[model samples]
Target: MIDVVVIGGGPAGMSAALVAGRGKKQVILIDEEKPRNAVTHETHAFLTRDGTKPEVFREKGRRDLLKYPTISIKNSKVLSIEKKAEDTFEITTESGDIINAKNIVLATGVTETLPNVKGIENYYGSSIFSCPFCDGWEMKDRPLILIAESVQALHVLKLLKNWTDNLIVTTNGNKIFDTDQKKMLEINNIRLIEERIIELKGIDGELQSIFFESGEKINRSGGFCTTVLDNRLPFIAQLGIKVNEAGFVIADVMGHTNIKGIYAAGEITGPSQLIVSASQGHMAGAGIIADSCEEAFQSIQK
Candidate 1:
């Protein structure tokens, strides 16, 4: 059995495998290549890797892991996981291969539910985005809009103000903001449109204007929108990993999940930046190494 089996070969999974491999543990990293950031053009806030394309960053990371003979990467999808014993897990892949792992690291990230607005998909990852910190600089000083369907809209609105002065907030008819909040935005010279978005008209993946269901329209170069994030992994329910009220897997700062032999990192734990996710993966690697070493020492004493 391998010392660690990391599910999802994104930054978090790759980082975990590298750390565990460096600790002299045999590690297997499996991925399906459908990362949450696959649509994103470039990743930001990762020092020395800022503005690097997601694919490029991942390639560099995998290349670095090649130096460690103990680490192996598989391009595959994990179908399910069965805990056969306390220290053993049987992970079934789509190809019908079964992998036995002493420990499991779930780095499967969250999936975003794009708004139902027409033509938004064409602009997403280009003109429209979720994180201001990631795409704000690119749209700086441009006419921007904040589309939200949740309370988190307020937080995003506040963050976007730093990147653009001309801003508008819309709840897509959800009424996420109250009268007081609307007044506050108006006081700051920001427009609040509570109308439902009918469509996003753009050209060449660049947003030009948004049409409201009420026949109103506003011109916007680009904007950010709030998305519903959920952990959609079937193994989370199968393994009985505890999830918080926000529907995110619950893991301590050290990446210890409620399940003894299972740990989690990256967006699966919660909302995290790229660097933060990588750091969490590193911690999870250390935790796995410590636990495996302790188990071996105890076996020797026995």
Candidate 2:
């Protein structure tokens, strides 16, 4: 059995495999390649890799992992996981191959559900983004709109204020904010539109204007929105790994889950930045190495 099988190819998975390989542990990195940010044109806030294309960053990361002889990467989808023995897991892939590993790094990131706005997908990852900190700099000082369906909209609105003053907030038919919040926004010169969005008109993936069901329209160059982050793997709960109320996998600082042989990292633990995910993966890898070494040493004592 391999020392570790990382079940996601994002920054966290790659980082964990890197650490394990450096520690001379056999590691396998499996990636489905269906990243949540696949539509994003550029990735930001990752130091030394800021403004890099999402695919380009991944390509570069895979190349770095290839340098380690003990680390192997498999471009395939994981279908199921079964516990074969203590501290061992049998991972079955869509390719029909079965891999056994002493440790697991569950790094499958979250899937996003944007506000129920028409044609949002065309503008998403282009003009309409989820994180202001990631794309706000590019759209700073421009007329922008925030389409949110959750209370998290309030937090995003506050953050976007730093980038632009000409902003509009719409709940897309959901009354996520109350009268007090509406007055607060109006006091700050921010417009709040609580109508349902009919359509978002854009050109070349660039959002231009949003049309409401009430015939109200506003033109915006670019902006951010709030999205629901969900775990794609429901079967993870079957593994006896604990999850928090926010639907995030519960893991300690070292990425150790309730299950002794398994670890959780990246967006699975929670929505995380690229740098943070990578750091978590490094920690999980180190934890596995430390635990495995102790296990072997105790076996020798027996």
TM-score per candidate, in order?
0.96, 0.97
Candidate 1 per-residue lDDT, tens place, 165-252, comes to: 9999888888777789888898988998889999899898899999998999899999999888898988898889999998899998
Write candidate 2's Cα lDDT for 1-302 as tens digits. Answer: 88899999999999989988898999999999988789999999999999999999999999999999999999999988888766689999988889998889999999888888878999999998988878889889999999989989999999999999999998999988888988899898999898999999989999899999899889998878999999968558778788999999999988999988899889999997889999999998898888878989999999
Error of 1 at 291 (Å): 1.8
Name the regions of candidate 2 deviating beyond 4 angstroms: none
Off by over 4 Å in 1: 299-302
Candidate 1: minimum summed lDDT over ten consecutive residues — where?
114-123
Every candidate's lDDT: 0.90, 0.90
Query: Which run of 10 residues does model 2 get worst, by summed lDDT?
Result: 232-241
